[model samples]
Target: MRSFYGVVACLLLLQALLGANARAETDTAAAPPAEVLTLHEAQRRAIEGYPSLKAVGERVLQAGARVRQARSAWLPQVEASWTGSHTDLSDVDVESARRGARSALAASGATAGLPSTSVTGSIIRLRNLAGGAAALGGIPESVDSYRVSLGASYLLFNGFGRKHTTAVAKYGDRETRAARDEATRLLLQAVAQSYHAVQLFRERIRIAEADIAFNARLLKEAKLRNEAGAASLSEVLNFEVRSRAAEAALNNARNDYANARTALSVLMNMEDGTLPENVEVETLGVETEEQMSLPDGEAALQTAMASRPDLMRSQWAVKRAGATVGQRRAALYPSVAAFASRDASQGGNSRFGEDDFSTTVGLNVSYDIFTGGRNRAQIAEAKHAQKEAEYQEDEAALGVVSDVRQAVEDLSTAQKQLVLQRDNARYVEKNRDLVAQEYAAGQTSLALLNQSQRDLVEAEGNLALARVSLLAAWHTLRTATGETVKDWPLD
Candidate 1:
């Protein structure tokens, strides 16, 4: 029997263990996979997952809840409650009081009249009955009580304060929503900037790599010419130095690229500032002419005024402040409300059913007759706030216009500069090619070849920077106008 019991226990334990392992495997399988995201995906995730934006989203929800709370004033409120208590009602000596009253009445009466015995006897009997009833009524030491009640009050009128409060909350909610949108836009812009920065560094590194290759080729030619007794030792040494410098520059560019990538990953809130290997950015491709066209400054400014979330938020804030002023002014007027209640109770140290129920319904009106000038001060404060909000809205609009204009100007300048830099790069490339051919033919000095190569590298780097600058300017213009990249090929 012991062996059989042990076998049963071991089987049960094994089954439990198997179930636990199965659950663990299931949970592991259910876990979400790691993300591989594009630029758009990064922006989406940032807006949805970033702590700052989530906080702002919480504010928006709170504001919306406040609006509902303010609007709830018009709805009826109902509640129900039950109460039980023990009360002492033995303070009064009812039996003694009744006997004293009977004695006094008999003394004052004219008992000397005929039939005094009978009348006195009847009065004595009546007094005895009353005392007995009083004694019985006072027999209980304490009274057990129970009460159940339900009540509701509706704000029929509150000098329109309820309406004004609701309006204020609604406007505040709108302001928060606009603020959140603005925050999202800014976050997207930050991601774009960081992502573009990474691309910029990557391009620069490529340019550095190209320069390294060119220098390596030159160094090899110089070494070969010197071995053949055609090149001077000084030329060979200069080529060696140039090659080393190019390698160093390449290393620096690579480091900068890594840093830029890390920054982008951080902005996107990726795990450990690391992006998935499969993710490919769209804007890292070669630039095209269509992607570089500058929008009209006037049009951009117009768009900014209409679409900028901050400006819209400011506008709503002004309205919210105006509603607050209304709410404050409402304090000067009276408010009327309707109320209703029902109560049921039982007492006398008895059962629960031995009780009576009562109902009450009424309308209440209230007005702050004297507030020591508090209401006036609040009204004044609200008005000042309204004025300040209005001023801020106007100021924000002006700032938007200025930003749009400046961004347009900067973008135009960058575009023109990019053209000039590209032309210079082409010329430098041609000169470097000529110098390379002459050096190989033993006709040109190594110093001239080195100078040409250096010039070409500088020009190429400048051209790459100019392209990045133009792109950044375009992004700035779009951001200032509350727009995004549209009709522009990112890659």
Candidate 2:
């Protein structure tokens, strides 16, 4: 009886443990769902979070600061200064006293031997010596001197150097902004590709699962038929093998889906390097004829030329380089400036009286006399840079045309492929269904039914790929034409 009670207690403990586990699982499942991440939301996150994009944005700010710095040269400069010093004059006083005594003795001796005119001259010399001695004796042992001044200067002329510098800075700023926009456009394209890849792999997984289910159902029927001595053992084994293959395909599709999600997470700069389980990507919508229409190639090229950010940046670079050339050439001319200053200084005391103040004004001019051809070398370098920039601009224009044309052609091909794949998938699926029915009625061979199923699977995968390709091609065209950057809300 005691052993029975112990067994009952063990059963109750196990039941409680199971109930607790069930409750815990229920609590976990009751957690709120995370918000779904749409494609646009993912792009917004990338714009805000991507480190490279942020780095590019910082360059725009740096260029803006440079522009401000260049413009500051147009304004007058003002400055203020204060200076103080202390000096000891005791030794200087002693030397002056010794000189005075020698002068007095000489004056007295000359007066004794000379006539009336000579005596008057000696008296004048002696008086001057006494006054000098008095001034020297009155000198302080230490002296304090202080000065305060305010000055202003304005550039009268600089051979248009300031104008050219400002222009260069402004153009550089615009170029940096355009470069940033281009980076954003490219980032958006990368995000779109990954986003669509996830959807494509998910659809493939569904197709794989369906294939597995069909094979499993057939395998069960084959087993029953074998037991009834109608179907051979080889038939059952064939369905088993096909079922395993379908499972392997399903696993591969799942791995692809995960990889696509990981790629998207990287683009969005997710902290965990993967999206959360609850944050699901939206399913792709049905494609329509209107959505698959091709754009005119010539119009796309024109739009790209007018709107492409990289092309715009290249144009700005050329302008900036030209301005730099002008700025360097300005060194060949003289520079002129106007200046004004007011100063107050005092000695022997800290206070500066009104009488101690002084004022001055002037115009200054300067020209470089010689520089061992340095100025000319600088100008030459700037001219070379300008030429390089022009070449880059031409290269960029050609690249834009090529990119637009390629993108348009890709889009056209994708559109046609999608239509063809859609029809092929429909026919393949119908054939698979008829084959499956014939196999079930024992009117067709298992090999024919297997081939039909395989064909259907291939067709479906191709159709999904075509859809993703079309979407990617459309985005590519938008990026090439700079419409992606225009449509994005950078602010």
Candidate 3:
């Protein structure tokens, strides 16, 4: 009985542990849900999270700092320093001569064995005289000394050089800001392309799956016919080969879909490889029918020239170059400045003591009388730079018009292609259905049924591509126009 009870207990414990593990696994599997991302959301996230965008923001900050630095030249500059030193005063000998003179007098004044007391008195008096002479002749040398000095200078005038530099810095900042905007627009366009690619692959994957299912059904029908002696063994083998080929195509489609998703994930800076399976994109064909509100190509070109960030950036570059020319020309005139300084020194016995102080305020004027033609060369370089910027501005305008016209053409072509592809897909689908019915009735050859299904898949894939292409072309047009971020699909 005890053995039976032990067996029952062991079985119950095992079951409980298994149940707990199953529950744990279920919870673990449900912990993380998939993230759904739309096309506009993907672009928005990419723009907000992209490293290149952050780098441009840092550049703008640095430019602002430069502007502040240039303007700070007008503020007073102050500086101070403390210096200390110790000297050895032992080498200053002032008692050697005095001691020698005293020794000579003592030797000359002493009488030979006259009186010990008189000789002693003469030696003591000479020693005292020497000590007094040494004390009076020597000058006390200081062992430690210190000095503290503070100075300040202000730019009363620099022939407007500072003003011109500040202006140049400001213009450069503006140019950088415009460049950042242009970069953002380009990034959005790239995101749109990547997003459409993913959507296109998804549609292709559906087509491939449908093809696989149809091929399987045909293979089964062929095998059934062969078993009943209505079809040849070679026909069954042919259907088997067709089914394998369809599966291979399906695998390729799946790989393409995965690659497309990975590209989008990288663009959005996402680390996790999870993608929502239900995310759908706007159908470009349907959207096109909803509206045709953009201006004509000529009007678009004018808007691009007026509002394009690249063109604005080039204009600012010209302004900055002009300011640089003014700054270089200012070198021809003298600079005037106001300056003031105070110096204090302490030197005494053995320690630092305040002993002297001085203060002075003065106006400074300076000019380079000769520069070996450096100033003229610099001014000429600035002029050339300004001309280059102007030329670039004109080039940018032409490029804008060219881009608008090309985008318009592309959009029109894509729209026409989409319409044709839609009609083709519908016709092929109808043909495929008819052929499938005929094949089931044993009135159509396997080759004809397979070809019809292949045609249908190809037509559908083309239609999907055309739809994405149309959307991409529309995005390109919007990018060329420099529409603000607020005009995007995000709410």
lDDT for each residue of candidate 2 in 195-239, tens digit (9 for 90 to 100): 989989999999999999999999999999999999999999999
TM-scores for candidates 1 onward, in order: 0.80, 0.84, 0.80
Candidate 3, run of 10 with poorest lDDT? 107-116
RMSD of each: 14.1, 5.9, 8.8
* Local distance difference test, each candidate: 0.80, 0.90, 0.80
Tens-place lDDT per residue, model 3, 1-491, is 99999999999999999999999999879866545567778887787788888798788888889989988887999999788888756543435545665665455445332454676776766666565556545545435788888899998877789899999999999998888878787788788888888778888888888887887887888789889988899878877887788788888888987888777777777767535555544433365453333448888787787778888999999999999999999899899988888888776433433456588899999999999999999999999999999999999988888888998888888878888998999999999999989978889887898789889988999998988887788888888877744354221
Top-TM-score candidate index? 2
Q: Which candidate wins on lDDT? A: 2
Using lDDT, rank the candidates from best to worst: 2, 1, 3
RMSD of 1: 14.1
